[model samples]
Target: MSRLTLAGMALLLPGLTLGGEWSGYVEGQIRAFTQEPQFDEQGDSTFSLAFEPEYYQSWDRNQQSLTFTPFLRLDSQDEARTHFDIRELLWIYAGDRWELHAGVGKVFWGVTEALHLVDIINQTDLVENPDGEKKLGQPMLKLSFEQDWGTLDLFALPGFRQRTFPGEDGRLRSQPWVDTDLTTYESDREEQHLDFAVRWSHSLGDWDIGLAHFRGTSRDPSFNPVVNRDGDLVLAPHYEIIQQTSLDLQATKGDWLWKLEAIHRGGLDDPFNAATGGFEYTFVGVAETDIDIGMLSEYIYDDRGDDAPVPFENDLFIGLRFTANDVQSSELLTGLIKDLDSDALMFNLETNRRIGSSWKGALQARFWIDVPREDPMHAFSSDDYIEISLARYF
Candidate 1:
C-alpha cells in the first residue's frame, strides 16, 4: 500500500491502522523551596529538563503492532535524579479473542484515589516524583484471554528492578542516604529473579471488579543500616521474596463514584492486610457556570498499624477537584492526608493549564504540618516547596 493511503487508513481506524507516527514533549521545571534545607549539602532550589519521545507503527491487517518510547532527564542539583529509561518498547499481536504483549511496558492496578495499594507489576520510579504515579517499564510476556465469564491475564516477568532513591544532595531524602551498591535480595538470582502474576477482571452493569495475585521478589524494600567508608551510616535496600493477593473494585452511579483497593501480603516477619477505600461526588455545571467540582474522601488502614514499616498505617485523605471546562482544559486538585492517631498533616496542591496550542504550564506545592518527632515524615518538616514547569509538544 502507498504511504499516503496507509496514513489515511490510520486516521480512520486508529488501533487497527497501518501507518507510523512520532510524537513527544520537552519540559523545563524549577523548584523553589520555602525554607532552608535541613542538610548542609542540600540546596534551596533546583532545575531540570526532561523529554519523552514515542514512535508507533502497525501492520498485518492490524493484528500486529509495535511501540517505542524513551525518556531522559537531567537535573541541575542531584546526580542520582538525572537518568534515562525506556518507558515502553512493546510488540503486540491481537487475535479474535486473545492478545499477546511482549517487551518492556507499564501496567497499573488499583481503584482508590488516595493510594494504589495493589499496583505491583512495575517498579516505582521514585526520582521522577514522590507521588509514586510514575513507573519504570517492566520486561514481561503477557497473554490475555477475553471470555464471557471474565477477562484473564497472565504475566511472566523475567527480571527485577530495584526501586530508585534520592542521593545525598537531594531534597526530601532520608536523614541517611541510600547506598544502592550494597543492595541485597532474598532471591538467589537477585535482579534476574523471575516473577509471575495473574489477574481476572469482569464488568457487571455499573460495577467493575478485579482480583489478582503476585509471587516474586517484592518491589517494596526495607532499609538495612550500614556504615560506609567515611564511617557514615547509610541505608542499604533489602529485597524480600513475597506473595500478595489483591482485589480492586469500582462502581459508578450518576454523579457518585466509589472505589476500593485491598491487599493481603506475606513476606516479612508476618502476614499483613491493608485497604484503601474512597468515594468521589461530582457536581456538574455548578450554579449554572461552566465549572465542575468534585469532593473526595478515603480511609487508609494497615493491620500492623503504627508498627508498619511505611507510613499510612492509619490515615484519612480528603481532597477537592475543580475543572474549569475551558478550551485550554484548566484544572486544580488539592488534597490533605492526616494521620488518624496524631495531629500530623500533609498537604499537596496541583494546578495545570494549557498556555496555547503547543505549550502548557503546571504548578505543584507540598507542605508538612505539625509532624511528630517519631513519624517517618518528620524528616521533611522543613522541606516545603513549590514546583513550576512549562512544556512544549510536537
Candidate 2:
C-alpha cells in the first residue's frame, strides 16, 4: 500500500473500523550513561541512539482475518558495548477470539516487579547482541485467545537444533563454565535451541492477575566447542531449564492505590541449585493528595541462590515521587535507600518531561555509598551513574 494510504488508515481506522484495524507507533531515543566499576574494576561508558518503529495492519475481508506487523530496532551503547541491532516480523491469522502468530518477535509473559522472575519470551536478558541490546527477539509460533474473561498465550520455538532440557547429570551448565572464552557463540548466526512459553491474564473487579511459564534451552551452551577435557573432540550434550510462577494484585480506593507482586523462579537451569530457586517480591503503595502531587513507597526482598550470579543474594529499596503538573506531564522522584543485606545507602533521582504531541525526555541517576567490590556474571554493575534520554514518536 502507499504511504499516504497507510497513514490515512492509521489515523482514521481506530474510530471507524468495524472488522479489521491498522495501527502502530514509531519511537526513537538518544541516551548517555556512565558506570564506575566497583573494587578497582575496569570502568566503561556509553552514548546511544535507539529506535523502535512498528507498523501493523489487520484485515478481515470475510471469515478469514490476517495481521502483519513489522518492527525494527537499532541501538548504540548497550551496557558496555557500542552498537546493537535486531528485527521483528510477525504475522497472525485469527477467527473470533483465537489467533495464531508466527515468525520472530517479542513477548512479555507476565507482570513481575523485580524483573528477575518476569521472563522475556525470546532471549532471557542474560546476554546481548554485539550492539549491547538484549537478544530478546526470537523465532517462534504462538497461539492466543483474548476473551471477555481473560487472555491466554501458548507458543513454541521449533526447527532450530537447540538444546535446553536439563543435561544428563541434571546440572545447569553455560559456555563460561565449560570454556574460558565465548567468541563464536555470541553471534545470531550460531544460535541453536528450541524455546517455548505460555501466559494467562484475568481480571476480578478492581484486581488483575496473571500467570506465566517458560521452558527453553540455554543460550550460554550453544557455542560450546564440543570437546572433551583431554582436548579431544567429544560431543557432550548440555541443556538448561527455567521455570517461573508469579502472582500480582492491584486495587484502587479513594486517593490510594496498592500493588503487590510476587515471583518464584526455579527449575534445573537457574543460577543456583543450592536452593529450589529464588524469589523477589515487591510492594508499592501510592496516594495522590492533588492532581499534580503524590506520595509513594516501594519494598523489595531478594533471596540468593547458589548458582545465581548476583551479590549479597538479596537487595531492597524504598522511595517517593512528585509531579509538577496535574496531568503529570512532568515529574521528579527521589529517595534515600538502603541495601537490605549489605547495609549500604544510596540517593536516587529520576525525572520525566513531555513535549508537544510526540516526544518525551527522561533523566535517571543514582549515588552509591560504600559500593561493593565485585563484578557479577554478564556485565558489571556501577557504584554511580547517570542516564539521560529523549524519545520521539512519529
Candidate 3:
C-alpha cells in the first residue's frame, strides 16, 4: 500500500464512524501475451486482483461533504505492479457563489479522446495501464468561484507523486530497468516543492471552453543511463520543474462533435508546443437498429517533431466507437495510431458490458507493429497482450 493511502485511512476513520455511505468493487484481471517476453525474467501471462472502495457523507443540508476512496491491486507476476493508492479522500464545502475543497483528489482536463495533451494536474499511474488513463490522487487545497463570466478554480498542490514504472521482471520495458531509487529532482526541496494551478471554464451555446496554467514539478520524467551500485546499467529518472499553459475546447452540433487540446510547456531541454484535435460523427440508429456507430479521426502534432520522446508526435489516430443502446450497456472502441514520419504503429481495442445487475466484464487488447529500433515503443514490440477482467460491485 502507498504511504498516502495509509495516512488517508487514518485521518478518515472518524468520518467512517459518522454513518457515511459506502460502495466499492473488487475485480480479477488476466493478461495473456501473444508472443514470448523480450526479457528472460518476464513471463507470458500475468494475473492480478484489485479492490476499490468508496465512502461518502453529506451534512448541513448537503452543503458540506466528505468522500474517501481507496484502491489496491495485488499482482502475481511483477512486484512493482502490486500497489495501492488513495484515489480520493476529500472534504468539500459549497456556498452560494464560492466553494472550498481540501484533501487528495483527481482532476481531469482535456477534450481529445485519443490523447490528453492538456491533462497535467495529476500524475499518470503508468503501472495500471499503458493508455495513461489512470491517475494518482494529488494533495490539494482548492478554492473556486462561480461568477457571471465563468468558473474560476484556484489550486494549491502540496505533495508530488513520482511516476511508477515496471520492474525488471515486468513486461513492456526496455532491457535495462529503471532504478527509481536513484530518482533526482530539479528543486532543492524535491517532493516538498509547492505546486499551483488555476483554471477558468465557461460554456457558450454549443461550445465549451477551458483554459488553465500550472507550475511545479513535471509529471513526466527523463531517464539517464547510469550504473547502479551493483555495477549494473540502469535508467535513472530525473524530474524537472516546468511551467505549462493549456486549453481544451469542444463543440457539439447535433450528432457531430469536435474536440481539441493544446499545451505549451517550458522547463526541459527547450520549450515546445503540442496539440491533438479531432472530430467524431455519430450515425444514430445504424441500419434501423438501436446500435449507434461513430467514426473518429484525430491529428497529433508536436513542435519537436521526430525528436520528441513521446510516440504520438506527428501521428494520426483513427478510431470507431460502437454503442449498444440496450439494458446491458455494451460499448466498444477500436483505434490505431500511425506515426507519420516512421513505420511505428499501435492498435488498440477496448470493450465492456454489464454482465448482470451487479457484475461487469471488460476486455482490452494492444498491438504494436513495424516499430523500428529508433522508436521508444521498440521495447514493447513483443509486449502485445490482451487483458480480461470481471468486477463485482456492491
Candidate 4:
C-alpha cells in the first residue's frame, strides 16, 4: 500500500484520534472517444476507463499542524493495456500570518471562461499518454501568507515524475526524471525553485472581484530537439522564467451573473525562438433560470506574437454550456449540443445525481469537429474528436 493509503487506514482503526481531521474522496470514470473517425486528418479514436481515489488529513491540535494529501489512479482500455499512476502525496505546515506548506500535490493556475490564458495555478487536467496511461500533475512545495485583504504564496518547483508527449513527427519526446535519472553532472544540478504568487479578493454589495499572480521557473528538465519540421537536426534551449497575472470580476444582478477575467504573461526566454511570452484574455456571462437549468456563454482571445516562446496564435472563441434539464427529457436523455468555436464545434451532454450521503455520480459526453481554417501548417490548428465519460465521486 502507498504511504497515503496507510495513513488513511490509521484514521479508521477503531480507537484512533491524532487530533487531526481526515477526509477522503473516490472517483471512477469511463471515456469513449473517436478522433477523426472518418476524415483521418486529426488523430485516432479511443475508449478507456479511469479510477481515482484521494485522501487528506489535517492536524491542527497543537502549535504545529500538518496536512497530508495523497491519491492514486488506474486506467484501462479494451486494447489489452492498463496503466497506473500516483497523483499526489505531500505534507503541509500552517501558521498564523505566515504559513509554511510543502507537499507533492497538483496546482491550478488560470482564470478565464473558454480557455486558460495565465491560470498557472495547479491541477491535473486528465493527461493521457500514447499508451493511454493517465499522467497526473507534478508535486510541489509552497509557502503562503494570509493578510486582512489577500494572500501571497511562494512555492518550490516539483521534483517528481517525468512525462513524454508526441512530437511533430509522431515520435515520443523524452524528458528527464529527477529521481530516477542521474548523470555525470548530477551533483551540480539544482533540484529546487522559487514560485511566487499573490491573490486578493473583495466584495462590494453583490459584486466580487479577484486578482492573482504566479511566477516560477520550469521544474521538468528540457528535452533536446532532435528533429525540426523539415527533418533537420536542432537543439532545444533552456528556460529562464514564467510569470503570469490574472484579474477577475463577478457581479450578480438579481438572477443574472456576469464574470470577466484577463491574463498577461511575461519573463520568457523563448523555447522555440527567443521572443518573450505574450498574453491571453477570457470572459463569461450566465443566467440561472431554475434549479436545474441555466444559460451560459464564454469567450477567449490570445495575443501572443508569432515569435514568442510557445507558438500559440491569436484566436477567437465563443461557446455555450447547458445542462440536461435545459431541454426536454427526451433531449436530455439524447444529450444536447452546446458549443461553437472558430476552429471547432462541440456537442456535449452531462448528468449528475447524488447517491448516498458520501457518494455522487456523473456522466459526460462530448464531441468535437474542427471547422475548416485558412491554413493547415499551423501547429495549434486542428480537428475532430469524441469523448464520453462516466464518473462517481465520494
Candidate 5:
C-alpha cells in the first residue's frame, strides 16, 4: 500500500480501537457518451470506482468529537482522475450555544438548485463531477455562536486548492485540456494567502434567511488562453482577490417552498449582480398512494448578459422530483435549464434506489438540445451522456 493509504488507516485506528462509529460506501460507475470522442485517443466510454470511509470519535459525553472521512477514486481512462482526498478531518467542540471546529472540512452555504452562487468555502473538484457539486476539503478554523436573534459563524481559512480537470485522453474535456499545474494567482501570497468569512443566519416564523460576506481569493478562476510549446492553445487558471456579499432566503408554507439567492462581487473589472429565485410545490400522498411529487421552477439573471461565463444568465429552470415512501427508499429528480437569449437547453435526470440493506444503485443522464454557437455550452453540445453506478455500504 501507499504511504498515504497507510497514514489514513493509522488515523482510523483510534476509532476502531475505541469502538467509535464507522461507516462508508464503495461505488463503481460507468459513463457512456452518445457522440463521438471530441479528441483523438479519447474513448466513448469510461469507468470509475470510488471508496469512502468515515470514522467518528466522541468524548466528554458527546460534547467533543473528531471525524475522519477519507475518499479515494480510480479511473480507467485518465490517470489524472485517480486521486485521494480527505473530505473531512476535523475536531468539533460544542458548548451551550457555541461551537468550534478546527481542521479540514466542507461547508455548504447555498439553497439554489440550479446554481450555487454563494457556496464558496471549498475549492470545486470539477473532474469528479460536471455539476460542480463535489468539493475538495478546506483547511480552516471555524467558530459559531447561537443567539436569540440569529446564529453567527466566523471562519479563518488558510489553504487553497486548485481545481482539477480532465486529461487529454478524457472524453468530457475540450480539445485543449486545462493545465492545472501552471495556475497563476494575482496575489503575491498566492495560494498561501489567508482568507476569512462571516455569516449570520436567522429563522423568523416561516422564513429562514442568511447573510454572508467573504474577503479573499475567489474560488472560481478565470482562464487565460496561451499557446504552448507544442503549438496547442491551452487554458491556464488565474485566481484573484474578491470581496463578495451574499444573501439567501427561503420561506416554507404548507407544501410550498420559496427560495432566493443574490450576490454582489467586487474586485473585478466591473462589479456585477446576480440572483436566482425559485419556488417548489409538493403534492403529498399523490392519488392516495405513498408517493410524493414536487414541481420546481426558478429564474436566473445576471447583469453580465452575453459576457457571463455561464449560460445561466436570463435562463429558466424547471424540475420535478419524486419520492417513494417504501423500505427501499427510491427517489428521482429531473430538471431542464433553458436559455432565453439563444437556442441553448440542458436536461438532466437522476434517480437512485436502495437494492438492499447495504447496496444501492443510481442512474444519471444529461442531454443538450439545440445548442447555439454563441452559447458557452456549445463546446459540450456533443458530450451528452448517461452514467450508472452501484454502491455497497459498510
Candidate 6:
C-alpha cells in the first residue's frame, strides 16, 4: 500500500479503539458517450470505482465528537481521476447555543438548484464530476452561535485548495490543456492565504433568509492563454483576491417552495451583480398513490451577459422532480437550461433507488443541444453521455 493509504488507515485506528460508529460504501460506475470522442486519442467510454469510509467518535456524552471520512476513486480512462481525498476530518464541540468546528471540512451555502452563486467555501473538484457538485475538503476553524433572532456563523479558512482539471489524455476538456501545476497566485502566500467569512441566517414563520460576506482569495480561477517555448498554446490558472456579498432567501408555503440567491462580487476588473430566483410547486399524493411530483422554474441573470465566464449568465431553467414514497425510496429529477439569446440548451436527468437493504443504484444523463460557439460550454457540446452506478453499503 502507499504511505498515504497507510496513514489514513492509521488514523482510523483511534476511532476503532474508541468504539466509534463506522459506515461507508463501495461503488462502481460506467459512463457511455452518445457521440464520438472530441479528441481522437480519447475513448468513448470509461469506468470508475470508488470506496468511501466514515467513522464518528463521540465523547462527553455526545457533547464533543470527531468525524473522519476518506474517499478513494480509481478510473480506467484517466489517471488524474484516480485519486484519494479526505472529504471530512473534523472535531466538533456542541454547547448550549454555540458550536465549534476545526479541521478539514465541507460547507454548503446555497439554495438554488440550477447554479450555486453564493457557495464558495470549498474548491471545486472538477475532474471528479461534470456538474461541479463535488468539492475538495477545506481547512477551516468555524464557530456558530444560535440566538433568538438568528444564527451566526464565523469561519477562518487557513489554507486553500486548487481546482483539479483533467489530464492531457482525458475527455471533456478544451483544445488547449489547462496546466494546473503551473498556476499563478495574486497573493504572495499562495495557497496559504488566510480567508474569513461571516454568515447570519434566520427563520421567520415560513420564510428563511441568510446573509453572508466573504473576503479572501477567490475560489474561481481565470485562465490565461500563453505560448510555451515550444510554440504550443497553454492555459494557466490564475487566482486573485476578491470580496463577495451574498444573500439567499427561501419561502415555504404548503407544497410550494420559493428560492432566491443574489451576489455582488468585487476585486476584479469590474464589479458585477448576479442573481437566481426560482419556485417549485408540488402535487402531493397524486391520485392517492403516495407519489409526489413537482415542477420548477428559475431565471438566472448576470450583469456581464455574454461576457460572463459561465453559461448561465442569461438563461432560464425548468425542471421536474418525482418522489416515490415506497419502500425502496426511489426519486427522479430532470432539468433543462436554455440560453435566452442563443440556440444553446442543456438537459440533465438524475434518478436513484434503493435496493434491498444494503445496495443502491443511480443513473444520470446529460445532453447539449446546439451549443453556441461563444458559450463556454461549447467544448462539451459533443460530450453528451449517460452514467450508471451500483453501490454496496456496509
lDDT of each: 0.88, 0.48, 0.90, 0.43, 0.87, 0.89
Candidate 1 local lDDT, 67-117, one digit each (tens): 778899899988888988877777788998999987777888888887889
- Tell me the TM-score of each prediction against the true structure: 0.94, 0.62, 0.96, 0.60, 0.94, 0.95
lDDT of 3 by residue, 23-55 (tens): 999999999999998878999999999999999
Task: Give the per-residue lDDT of model 2 (tens digit) for 1-394.
Answer: 2233433434443323544454544444433235443322223434445555554455555433333344443334332222232335555567689987766556654332223335446554322221112444466688989998798989887523332221111111222223322224322533454567777888878666777766665433423456556564433433444555555555555555566555565564333321112222222332434434445544555454322443324444455566555453787767654555554566668788877777777877755566454423222233255667777766
Deviation from truth (RMSD, Å), model 1? 5.3
Ranking by lDDT: 3, 6, 1, 5, 2, 4
Q: Number of clashes in model 4?
A: 10
lDDT per residue (tens digit) for residues 263-334 in model 4:
665564432211112222222332433323344544434443432232224433333334333322212222
Report the candidate with higher TM-score, 2 versus 3. 3
For each of the candidates, the C-alpha root-mean-square deviation to the true structure, in angstroms, is 5.3, 9.4, 2.1, 8.2, 3.0, 3.0
TM-score of 2: 0.62
Q: Model 2: clashing residue pairs? A: 78-132, 83-131, 84-131, 162-192, 162-193, 164-217, 271-307, 271-308, 272-307
- Candidate 3 matches the true fold with a TM-score of 0.96
- Tell me how candidate 1 scores on lDDT: 0.88
When summed lDDT is taken over every stretch of 10 residues in candidate 2, the lowest stretch is: 164-173
- Show model 6 residue runs off by greater than 4 Å: 1-17, 227-232
lDDT-superior candidate, 5 or 6: 6
Candidate 1 stretches greater than 4 Å from native: 1-19
User: Which residue pairs in candidate 4 have backbone atoms (N, alpha carbon, C) closer than 3 angstroms, thus clashing?
Assistant: 107-121, 107-122, 107-123, 108-121, 108-122, 109-119, 109-120, 109-121, 109-122, 110-119
Q: Which stretches of candidate 5 lie over 4 Å from their true place?
A: 1-19, 229-231
Best by lDDT: 3
